[model samples]
Each structure stands twice: as structure tokens, then as C-alpha cells.
Target chain A: MNIISFLNILLPFGYAVAVYAYGKAFFADTPWAKSSKRWILLSVIGTHIVYLAARTTAFSHPPATTVYEVLTLLAFTTSAAYYVIESRTGNRETGYFILNIPFFFQLVSSLFIKDLLEVPEILRSNYFGFHVTAALAGYSAITLSAVYGFLYLMLYHEIKQTRFGAVYRKLPSLENLERMSVMAIWLAFFFLAAAMLAGVVWLPQAFSDFSYADPKLIGTVFIWLLYGAALAARRSTRWKGRKMMIVAISGFVISIFSLTAVNMLLSGFHRFN
Target chain B: MNLLCLSISHHTAPVEVRERLWLSPEEIVKTLPETLRLGCSEAVLFSTCNRTELYAVTDGRLPHESLIRELIKQKNAGSVVHESHFSVYRGPEAAGHLFRVASGIESMVLGDVQILMQVKEGYQLAVNAGTAGFFLHHLFPSAFHTGKRSRTETTIGTGAVSVGYAAVELAERIFENLRKKTALVIGAGETAKLTAKHLRGKNIGSLTITNRTQNRADQLARVLECSTIPFDRFRESLADADIVIASVRVDTHILTADDVARALEHRHTGALFLVDIGVPRNIDPAAGKLENVFLYDIDTLTAMVDENVHKRRAQIPAVERIVADELHSLELWHASLQSTPTIQALTAMMETIRKGEVEKNINRFGEKDRELVELVTKRIVNKILHTPIAYMRNGHDAGPTERLLSVNVIRRIFGLDHDNAKRDDDA
Candidate 1:
């Protein structure tokens, strides 16, 4: 079979394995807890590598030519971020669901978008790789962190209710989740800032007139500020647990809207349309 | 033996009762043996600020119910206890409960993480007191193993954890390198003291402790190897401090906008960070609105701590799986205990039958020639018992019953288990 057909099959199979493995890791009575998750992680990475190779081979160029390629790259970033957060936080359960869902979309997107599509002239730049990759990486990490934060908040509520039995038995210590989310947000902040910085630096040379407040630009900045606020709130404000989780989730939502919705709809300088 | 656990934790009982019931290591050593003498084979006393639990594995013949009641009555003489005063789980269930407890599954704060060490300490205390017998020795190590397994294998022990650690994390965010930073603790209360200790552990270049009682501040300072400042000089110290943790009990906002603005004038442009851990609030919320000023109140910190608390909660299933996996091996060992003696008795009976058969058979061969035959018979018996005995000891079979039953087919060949005719029906 052709590479597209292979990827179409392999990618979805990987996603299925990831979901099943993650579920087994979360609920099984055996050593599948670690092994299953590790297998899923390996499968995702393997599939992504294959997908990248196929895309690169098909395009006869690097895989950053169109929105589809960027989406594919973003899928890889999300998986990478999820694994990093999972290892760092040691939180395999909550993060599993968050990590698996992104691949589902990426896999679906890939199946249909495999026929080489032409990119808008504005999209064909070396800076495109830096911008899309950084933003998505940041976005993925933020989403993972947001999930961790939500778990933290739920556990905190359970503790407050004075009903610490079954659910309490399953969660990580609150302090660990809080620390992990903070770390995730901080890492995302660094990447997002880098992405914005790259865009702004390259804007003047690339385009005749680059608006300072392009929708994507403005949205990206808003996410940066929101994350900055989260960091500040956590720092001087001592923002933790539920509050931190809410902020993380909110920040991820903003990122999604900025990166996807705004780019698809509004006639902004950065829109794919 | 009666195995019981009498506990007043952050659950059924409040902090006051828990603290009152708390016992030190010295106290555990003194009390454990006495508690065991009251009718237990093993006694492990776990007492911490958040919980006080007494776990005992005793003779099954002991009056487990009244014995625990009397112990609690003696311990909590003046205290009010209803019918639901303490929870009592028995047998394998008790073992499972304690395993979970040691694994931090039964913590009041849901993955508090310190209970495992405390459980270990309690086990050690029982061992030291000579109250932990073979059963307890086997049981406690399993519990410790389970705790370790749970912590390592599961996400329950992972993520944004620790309130004090989180506080330090927030502080680090303000000043990336704490080694060059100065930290000011504004109270001598538990939270403040803990925050100070966490900061100290982080090696924040200079630590200045300030409390209403200068002596308390000095005491912490000595322990932390830092200096102390007067409570009145808190505002004055704020400017020099790169991180300020306000843990004092003040009804009003101690650090006002003007106070922070003044501190900012003397502070490095991006350095100063403020944390208010006081209940009625310490630093004014409005101070955060000021340029280059970052202020966090107690409510905010608590919120952060709570959020992380939730995330860790989500990881509980993974941690529990770790605990359960380790507990599986332990259960196998425990179940083996039930059938071990039966296997031993069966093996002994079979060996006796084999020697008897050899003696009977050798009489026809004459004395000198029979010696070699006796040696051969003994060697045969040893060979026959080796695999089954080894497997049973490793907790494979219900004992040698299955192997011995199979050997009935070769009864004439090995001449084993003649007495098994009597015990077979009973077995």
C-alpha cells in the first residue's frame, strides 16, 4: 500500500492502542499500569515518525508547507508535550485522556489532507516552521498542565468535603500536581514568548505592512499575558490548586481559539484563509 | 489473634483529639509492649499531628472488642466518644486496611505523602518494643513495600505537590535563583515556620525571621541558621528582602500600597515578591496593583494548594494500582500461612512411611547388604520431597496435599503416606 494508506492505517491504530493502553494503565490490576502507558507512548512516537517521514517524502520538502502540515506537526508537538509532562509530573492517569484526544483529530485530519495541497504565498516561509511549531508546542503543554490543574482542583474539593476515600485514593498528592502545573505553564510561557518574538522579528522583512495587532498576533499576546498572570498569581498571589487549574484550563481555551478559530474565520494577517 | 486499629485522624476525629492522642517515639516504645501485653501479639502505634492510630495483631482468642474499648477509654478518659468512636477491621480486611494506610491511600488529606514514613516509624517502634512478632514483621514490611510501590508506580504521588514546596516554587518564579535572594518570614506560626523551613532548604542566601514574639523568631532563626528581626521592623525589612512571606496574625493589611511602593523604591527593579499567609490577610491585595509589586494573600495560596490537591487526587488510581500490585504478593504469602503446617505434617508423615517401608523391605536382604538399600531409600525419599517442598515453601501449592495425593498412584512404588489413609478423609 502507499504511504498515505499506511499512515491512515497506522496513525489511527496508534491512537486506538494509546486509548486502550492508557485505560488499562489507569484501571487494570496488573503491571500494565506502567507498561501499557509506555507502550502507548512508544506507539504514538513511532506513528508520528512514520507520519513525518511520509509527509516529508510526499511533499519533496520539509513538512511545513501548509495548514495541514502545520496541523500534523502540531499533533507531534502535543504528543511530545504530553509525554514530557507525564514523565515530569508522574501523572499518567489524568494526562492520558488529554494526550489521546489530540491525536484523534490529527489522525482524522491527515487521512483527508494527504493529497498535496498548495499553500497561500504568505504561508510559504522558513519563519512558518518556527511560528507554528512553537505555538503548538506551547499550546499542547498548556493543555496538559490544565488537565493536571483540573485534577488538583477536584482532589482539593474532595479533601474539603471531608470525604477522602476512593477518589482520594487515586489522586497524586496535591502539592505535586500544583508544582507540575506551574512548571508546565512556565515552560509553555517560554515557548509562546519565543514564538511571538520570532513572528514579530520576521514581520517587517517578510511583509510590506505587518499590523502590530493582527488577530493571531493579538490572541497569542493575550495567551502570553494570561499565562503571565497565572505565573504572577501563583507567585505573589500564592495561586494554587483549583484557582491554578481554572487559570490553566482557561489559558488553554484561549490558545485553542487563537490558534484555530481565529485563524480559520476572521480576515487577520495570520489567517490561513 | 485480634488485629485492631483505633484511630482519630483528620477524618473521624478533629485535629485537637488527634494531637492529644499523638505519641512520640519514646512513648511508642514504652506503650507498645504494654498494649501488646493487654492481649496482642503485635502492637504498632502511629501518632502524628494529623492522626493517631494504634494497630495491633493479637491472638484470635483475645477479647478484641472489649480490649480495644478499654484501651480507648483509658486513653481518652475525659473525651467524648460516641458509638462510632473508632473503626475496627478484622483479619485479612484489617491487613488490607493497614496496607492501604501505610500506602497513603487512607490519609485524611488524600495523598498527604508523609503517612507512609509515619507508618514505617510506627512499625519500627513496634519492632523496637518487641511487640512485633513474626506475623507483624512479615505484615509491616509488606505494608512498607506496598507504600513504596504505590508512590513509585502511580501518579497519585506525582505532579504539582506540596503546599510548602509550592510556596517555594512561587517564590522561585519571582526570583529564579534563590541563592542570591533574601527571604523574610513575618510570623512564627506553623505555616510561616514551615514556609521558612522550605525556603531555608532551598538555600535562599539570607533568611530573616520576624514574629510578634522575638524569642520564637530567634528560636527558628537558630534552627534555620538565619537571623531574626523584630516584628515592628517587618515593613523596614520588606525592602531588603527579595521574598517576603507574611504569616503573622494581624487583622488588618500589614503591607499597604504605600508600604510596598516605598519598599519598591529601595528594592531591585524586578526582585521583590510578597506572600501573605495570615488569615485576616497581611499584605493588601491592592499592593499587587502597584507597579513592579507582586503580592499574594493567604486565600490565594490556599487556592493554589487546593488546585494541586485536586490534580494529585486524580492520580490516586495509579498510586492505588501500585499498592494493589505489591499487596497481591503479600496476600499470597498470607494465604500460604493457612496451608503451610498442613503441608509440613503431610511431608513428615510420608517420610516416616518411606523409612518404615525401607526398614521392612531390608530385613529380607540381611544386615550388611541392607545398609546400601537403606541409603538408597533415604536418597529416593529426599528426591521425591524436593520439588513439592520447595514449591510449597515458595507459596505455590495449598501445601504438599496436591503432590501427596498424586503420589497415591505410586503408593506401592514409594510406599509413602500410609497414615494418609486416616488423614485423607479429614483433609
Candidate 2:
């Protein structure tokens, strides 16, 4: 393989190593391991950025039209999102679980990259690029929220059952996990809203005979309403902590199912080549 | 040089005996010089609630037991202490014990963070008193480094082990920020006071202390620099309080389900955490079942502390590895002290012989030629001495005994005696 493809293949492994380091730091309490994990993650992001740039130049459009390219973009956005959150919160303990999403996506994308095909002319617009980027960012944020929710429930059950195992000791406090989940949900809601707005504004101009009944559009709108309702419920004090965590986790699961069904099986304008 | 440690800790002595051996700051100042006068080459007196250890470096003339007895007698004045109350460790074991103590492995609560600071303070006090000499100057910093490594490299100091600390940790878990929360301590008991102290240390927004007796509440409030409410009126403040620590001792429950329900009604929008550390369960258990009300009693807090303690205990092997690594370096430094003088004497003797032989051959050469010949001969002599000197300094990774035997063989081969070795040390 050429240099860019070689680095692309290695990126997933680098993320795997970073995730492993985070786990070691969490369980072994090795301070240097956390720092090493961070640096390795940053290097992987740098290499991924270079690879994306190379692909964009080679394809004469943004690298968001093919299934593998979209998957790669999602992985990069999720990891970047996680890195930002980790830097802000100084909470590296949850990184092992949160990073697995990006690592898996990148691994699958790299393995199936040879199957990528040419995109239709209509799918190569800047508006479509913005729409895909915004959607990927929102999905990554939802994934992060789901991971935080998972950690919250795990710690909550551990505390309630008095297990006090490795999860109990290593994870952040329940309140912290709840707060982080809420924060990620808020980001997800904002980005999904922006993605929907972009798609709504661009569809009529690009297609000239736009239909609102597209499955991807309906799915995106449904996911948006779900998170929006979850955020609204959070404003009322009763639907907080555990209730909000469930909402975030369920929203993520529905979004993933919707995205997969729309991309793989449904006949839609948003389908990748 | 003999390193010795005489310690009386919670493990070795009861509170009564430990109290007798406890040295206050003033007592340390007064008695530390007396310890030096009693023929200790160097001394550091470390005293905390859990342990009191006096680490000394001394000449072999003074008996370790008698010296410790004299130092204790001088410090305690008329108090009688049995010899069995104190445990003595000498040489490498003494260094190891000090390292373990600094690393908090030997604490009553495993992996306490306070002992390291206490160790540092003890070393500083010894330095201030002009009692910490070369050995302690090396040992104390090494112990501190080991303590830092143990804390960072292992999970030893990761969690809260005390009930009061666990209560604070729970409060943190329930609330997003302690700075925005108010704590209501429901008794003037010690546990309540400690709980309040821990809350204050976390910089909680405000604190309210309540007791059946108004004066006791006021006393505690004054100490904690917070306001006090009449015992009957504490439930009114509970609506504003984010955390309620009920440590009161009473027959009936101080906070019932109805009371908590009323408080929750007033709270309206946030979580209310209740920690009942009292023996009789100050907060009703049913109150914990209420929405947005998190109640934890002493058993729960104790379980958390026990879990944390277990986690820290599991890190003992990792910490021990760090201690072993530090001890190895320290022993190497100590061994070099043994081998240094012999190495110096051997180098001096070789230089002397080389210079004497060079002078006998120098008369045949001119002045400039003599200078060149001297430089060449000096370089040759140094190159010849380099291998043996390096071997003497660092070849043996064995204990001091074997290293001492090796040094003795080198001394005999070089015809170096104690006087010549002393001269080399002075040089």
C-alpha cells in the first residue's frame, strides 16, 4: 500500500493501543499511561486528518460520499469529540469504553475501503458535505452520551448492589457521569438540529423536485425529536439522573438502527454510492 | 555509620502507651538536641496520631535500646514506658521501615496521604535543629521520592477510606459541585464534627449545625465558622441544604419520612443527600425511598470505606516494588561509601609509585622533554587505574557484607591500612 493507505490501515491499531493504555491507566493507576494514551490518540487523529485530506484531493470532492469514507469520517469526528471532552473534564477513566466506538468504525472502514465506488454528481455538493459532517458530529456526540449513560448505570448498579468492584472504584462519580451524559446530549441535539436544517435547506436546491418522505430524513427528524424531548424533560427535575441516562442510551440505539437501515437497505436520496 | 529507628505505633502500642510516647512540637524541639547530645550522630523525630518514630544515625558506641530509652525519658520526663512498647529496626531494615512509613503502607489506614507530609515535616524539623546529617539528608529525600512514586505509580491513594471522607465523597457523587451546596450537620457529636470539617475542607457553600442543646451547636458552629439553628428548627434549613449529615445519638429517629417529604417539597428541583452516621439511625430508612432523596447510613459509608481500603491494600505489592527499587539505590550509595576509601587509596598509591619511577627516569631528558614525559606518564597511570576503580565502585550488587569483604581484599592487596584509608577519606 501507498503511504496514506498504510497510515489509514495503522490508524485503527493506534486507536486500539490508545484505548488499551487508557484501560491500563484506569486499572493500574499509571499516570504516565494516561498521558501516553492521549499523545497516541492525537497522533492518530493527525494521521487521519492527513489521510482525509489526501482522499479529498484524489476524489475531487470532500471524502463523505462512499460508505467507507463516511464511516472513516464518523470515526474521526467521534474520536475528536471524545478528545475535546476528555481534555475539558480531565476524566480519562471512561476513555477505554468511549474510544471503542471510533476504533471499531475505523477498523471496519479500513478493512472494507477497497469496495468504495464513485459518487453521483448530485452527492458531491458542499451542502451535502456539510450535512454529512454535521450528522456525523451529532452521531458521535450521541455515542459519547450513550457511553456515559452506560457508565452511569454500571456505577449505579454497583453502588446499589454494593459490589464495589473495579468499575465502582475506577469510574467517575454517578453525578459526574450524569452531568457528562447530559452535556453530550445537548451537543448531540445542537449538531443534529444543525444537520437537519442544512439538509432541509439544501434538498430543494439540489434535487429540484424534493420530497420530505425520504426515510433518512424521517429517521433524522425522529432522532432529533427524541433528543429534543429528552433535553426538555431534563429541565424538569423529576426526569433527571437515571431517567435522562435511559433517554440518552435509547436515543443512541434508535439513531444507530435508523442510520444503518437508511444507509444499507432503504432507497433514499441520502444513500451512499 | 549505624542507622536505627525506634518506633511506637498503633500496631505496637495502645492509645495509652502511644500517648505517653507522643512528642509534641515543643517536646521535639527540646528533646531533639538532648538526643544528639546523648551521642546520636543524626536524628529525626516524627510524631503523628498513629505513629511516633525517631530515626537516628549513630556511632556504634551507644546501645540502641539504651539510647532510645534515654531519649524517651528525656522527652516524656517522668512517664514510664516499657521497652516492649517500642520496636527497633537497624541499618537497612530501618531505612526500609522509614520508606514504608513515608509511603503510607504501614499506616492504620492503609495509604493515608498525611504520613508523607508528616515525614517531610519531621525531616524539616531535624534540618532546622541541625540534627539531620549526610545520611538522613540522603535518606529523607529518597523516602519522599519513594512515597511520591508509590502514590503515582500505584492506586494506593486513589479513594477515601475514612467515614467522614466517604461521606464527603458521596456528597460529591450526588451533587455536581460542592461549592454550590450547603451541608446540615444534625449533631454536635465527633462524627458530625468530622463530617462538617471534611465538608468545610471541600469548600462547601455553607454549613448549619444543630443539636438538642443550643450551646453545643453554637460551640461547633463557632469552630466551623458557620451558623447554628435551634434543634427544632433544623428541618427548616434542610430544604436549602444539599447534604444533611445526621450523626445525632437518640432513641427515636430525628428525621422521619414525613419530615424528609416536607423537605423535598421545599427543595422542589434538586437532589438532597442524607448521611446518617449515628448509631441509632438518625434519618428514617423509608426517607431514602423518596424521589431525589439519597440516604446513606453508617453501614453504607463504612462499606465504601472498606472497599476503598481493600483497593489500596491491593496496591501494596506495587508500592513494595517501588520501595525495593529505592532501597536498592540507597544500598548502592551506602556500599560505595565502603568501597570509596579503598578505591581512593589504591589510586593514590599507584600515582605515588608512578611519580617516583618517573622522577628516577626524568634526569636524562631536557626540561621541555621532562614536561611532555610527565603528561604521558600521568595519562598512562590513570588509564591503568580506571578498570579496578570502576569495579571497586560498582561491581558487586550484593549486600554490604560481601562488598565489605571485597573492599578488604583490595585493601590487603594494596597494602592499605585503616590510617591510610582514613587519610584517603579526608583527602
Candidate 3:
């Protein structure tokens, strides 16, 4: 197989091993697993970077040209976002929870992905690249917030219920999880806002069929507003611990629905399937 | 040569007796040099609240009892603890003892996080006193390696193993930074004071203590150097607290579900961590059911402490295996030290015999013939010694104990053991 195909196969395989390594380190605390997990994750990230650059250069258009290609890029950006978080916090305990998303995303993307030899000239626009990158970053941040929210809730339940089992033993503290989730939500808001700004400024000028009332655009804006109000709301009426976590999770659900249903069912210039 | 560890610990002696044998830093400095005069080559003493272990490397000139007697005499602990309270481990067993102590398997509290540091301090004391030498130089690092491995490889050192730290742990579980959080301590009882101390150890931002009697609350606040709220105003202050430790000695619940729910309504805090460690329990059970309110009574904290202790206990076998592996590695390295001295002694004996015969026969020959006889005799001894030296160099597969035995065999075979040679001479 060519380098791209080999990387396509290696992406899921590499991530699977990293997941296992991180899981073993978290549960069993094996010496080898604890030592090797970070290096394995680093190698996988390196390979993923190479694969993305190669795929763009090989196809004459960026991977964001199609939904399937964007899935592959999403997988990369999500894992990349997690890498940044893990590196900064010096905590590798939550990697298994985070890496599983990209693992599955890459698996699906690799299976259905096609080589697009021809594309519209606008697909090569630097504005489109910025818009897609910002959108992917926004989605990745949303995924991080959702995962941290889920972990926060699990640990919260474990503490409140007095189980004090694996969820309590392994996961980060509720306060830390809350901070991470809020930070991610704030990050997602800015990125999605930027993506929307790019779309508004360029879509009306570039495409003949571009409409201001596209379903995808409306859905993204709705997600952006939901998180925006939650993060920026008043202190006395503000959502903090449990209420804030639930809002973050719900926002992620809405984003997923927008990504899947709105793109598949609705017709618009945003749908590039 | 032998490395010996003489231990008087909580396991073998009561705390009253162990305390009598405990050595202060000044006492250890004064007593450490006396070990060398007592016929030991090297010495290190681990004297903590629970254990007082004296590690010495002796040349088998002094018996273990005399060393034990000297230690007991040094402490003036004759009437306090009998000699039987001391547990003696020699050779590899002594190395194993040091490893277990460093790894916290022999600690009174299952995973003694501070014991490793204590071990380091003991080793450092020996180093400063110029007591530890060749053998200890290798053995203590192995013990340290064992300690590090046990902590990293197993979950022994993780979690709050002490029941008293449950409140602090729960606070940590809820909040990211304790420096930004405020804790309201209800009541001035012992449990409340202890919980306050625990929070203080974590450096809580603000501490507001309340008691039924305002004077007692002021006294405790002064001691802890925090503020005090009136007993009646404590409920109002609850809305501002991120953590409420209700350890009041009350017959009825001080915090009810309604009170907590009302506080949470006005609170923009992370979560309400209620640690009720009072007799007759201070917080209502229904308070735990409220959203964003986590109430842990004494029973729950005790249960978590018990489980954490069990988790640490379960890691003992793994830790022991690490100890054994490191001890074996050390012994093998020590066994390698054995061959060099043995080879030198053997060669010296052979050379002595060769020189004596050549001197007696030199007059019977010419000068040139005498030189020829000397060269022939030296070559013959060299050929005889080659096999044993080669065997010693190539014997890496020998296990720890077996390697030591093999070294003994070589000594006995070459008559390098002084005791055997003296015995043979007397016969």
C-alpha cells in the first residue's frame, strides 16, 4: 500500500495500542505500561501529523474537502487537543477516556474515506482552510469539555454516593474537572465564533448558492449561543458544579446532532458529502 | 564478613519500651563511632517513633549478642526492654530488613509515606558520621530503589490512608485549589479541631470556627490563627463556605437538607463538602441527598480509610517481591567482591612457599641456574591458579546464596580461610 493507505491503517491501530497502554497504566499501574504509554502516544501523534500533511499534498486539496476526510482531520485535532491538555497538566490518567474518541473517529474515517482528485477552486482557498481548522478546533474543544464533564459527573457521583471505587481512585478531582470543562467550553465558544465569522464573510462572496439561513449555520450558531450564555451568565444565577456539567454535556449532544443529522439530511453549501 | 540489622520495633516491643531505645540525632552521632570500636566496620541507625534499627557491618569477630548488648547499654534501656525484644537479621536477611523498612512494608501505618525519608535520613546520618562504608554504600541505594519501585509500581502510596484525612481528601476531590477555598468549622470539639488542622495543613484560604460557647471558639481560632463566627451566625456563613466540617457535640442535626439547599441556592461555589465527624452526628442524613451537597459522616470516612488501608496491604506481596529481587541483586554484587580477596590470599600463600624453597636451594646452584629455577617455579604456580580464577570470573549464573557458598568452597579448597588453616595447623 501507499504511504497514505498505510497511515490510514496505522492510525486506528496505533491509537488502539495507546488506549490499551493508558488503560493498563490507569487500572493495573503496570511498570511497563506506565513508562511506555506516553512515548507511544507521542509516536502516534507524530505519525498522524505526517499522515495529514501527506494526504493534503497527495490529494491536491486539504482533507477538509469532504465529510469523510474531515472526520479524519477531526480525529487528528481531537487527539492533538488532548495531547496539549495532558502535557500541560502533567496528568496522564484521563488519556484512555479522551483517546477512545479519536480511535473510533479514525476507524470510521479510514474505512469510508476516498481520494478526491478533483475539487472546486474554493476548496483550495486559504479562508476555507482557516474556517475548517477553527471549526475542527472548536469541535475538539467541545469533545474535551464533554469528556471532562462526563468524568466530573462520574467522580461526583462516586464521591456523593460514597462508592470511592475506581471512578474515585482514578479520575481527577471534581474541581479540576470543572475547571477543565469550563476552559474547554470557553475555548470552543471562541473557535466556533471564529468559524462562523469566517463562514459569514466568505460564504456570501464565494458560493452562488450560499444562503444566510443554512441549517448547519443555524445549528452551529445555536450551539455557540447555548455555551456562550452558560459560560457568560450572571454569577447569582450562574451554573457551576452539577448544573454547569449538565449544560456542557447537553451542548456536546447538540453539536453531535448538528454534525451528523444536519449535514446528512439537509441540503446546503455547508454539506460537502 | 556480615551485614547485621538489630531491630527493636513496635512489632517486638511496646511503644513505652521502644521509646526507651529510640536514639536522638545527638545520641546516634555519639553512639555511631562506638559501633566501630565494638568491632563493626560500618554502621547506620534508623530511629523513629515506631522502630529503632541498627545496621552494622561486622567482620564476624564480635557476636550478634554483644552488638545487641552494646546498643541496649548505650540507650540505658536495660530495665525498659529486655534483650529478647531485639530481632536480629544477618547477611542477606539484614539486607531484606532494610529493604522492607525503606519500602514501608514494616511500617506501623500500612504505607508509611514518611518512612522512606526516614530511611534516607538514617543513611545520611551514617554518611556524615563516616560510619557507612563499602557494603552499606551499595545496600542503602538498593533499599531506596525498592522504596521508589513500590510507590510507583503499586498503588500503595496513593489515596488517603489515614481516616483523619478523609475530610481533606473529600475537599480535594471537590476543589482544585484549596488556597482559594474557605472552610467553616462548626463546634470546638476534638474532632472539629482535628478537621480544622487537616484543612489548615492544606492551606485553606479562610477558616471560620464556631462553637456553642464563644470563648472556646475564640480560643481555638487563636490557636489555629483563623477567624471565629458566632454559633448563631454560623448557619448564615454556610452560604459562603466551600467546605463545612460539622463536628459539633450535639444531640440533634445542626445542618438539615433545607438549610443546605437554601445555602446552595445563594452559593456560586464548586460543591458543598460536609464532613460530619461528630458523636450523634451533626449533619442531617437528608442533607447528603441535596444536589451539589456531599455529606460524609464518620462511618463513611472510616469505611473509605479501611478500604484504602486494605488496598495498601494488598500491595505488600508485590513490594516484598521487589525487596527480594533487589536483595538478591545486592548479594550477587557482594559475592563478586569475594573472589578478588580470595585470589590475592591464594596467590600470596603460593608465592610464599615458592620463595622459601628457592631461597634454600639457591646456594646449591649457579647464579644463572638460580634465575632459571625461579622462573620455572613461578610458571608452575601460575598454571595451578588459572582454573580457580577463571571459574570465579565466569560464575555469574550462580544464585545469591549459592554464589556465597561457592565462594566459601573456593576458600576451603585453597585453604584461604584463616580459621580452617589455623585448625589444620593445630592438628
Q: Against the true structure, what is each candidate's TM-score?
A: 0.53, 0.90, 0.90
Least well predicted 10-residue stretch by lDDT in candidate 1 chain B: B398-407
After superposition, candidate 1 runs with Cα above 4 Å error:
A12-43, A54-105, A114-273, B1-115, B122-133, B146-182, B189-191, B194-206, B212-216, B230-233, B236-243, B247-252, B261-281, B288-335, B350-427
Cα RMSD of predicted structure 3: 3.5
RMSD of each: 10.3, 3.5, 3.5
Question: Candidate 3's residue-wise lDDT over B245-274, tens digit each?
Answer: 888777888888889988987787668888
Residue pairs with colliding backbones in model 3 are none
Q: Using DockQ, give the best candidate's number.
A: 3
Q: Which of the CAPRI classes, incorrect, acceptable, medium or high, describes model 1?
A: incorrect
Model 2 vs. true fold: TM: 0.90
Candidate 1 residues B192-264, lDDT tens each?
8888888888888999988889899888888889998788877887778878888777778877989988887
| Candidate 3 residue spans exceeding 4 A from truth | A31-39, A234-237, B34-39, B59-79, B213-227, B351-383, B418-427
Please, what are the lDDT tens digits per residue for candidate 2 over residues B135-243? 9999999999999999877879978899999989777755667988888889999989998999999999989898999999999999999999898888888788888
Q: What is the TM-score of chain A in candidate 3?
A: 0.94
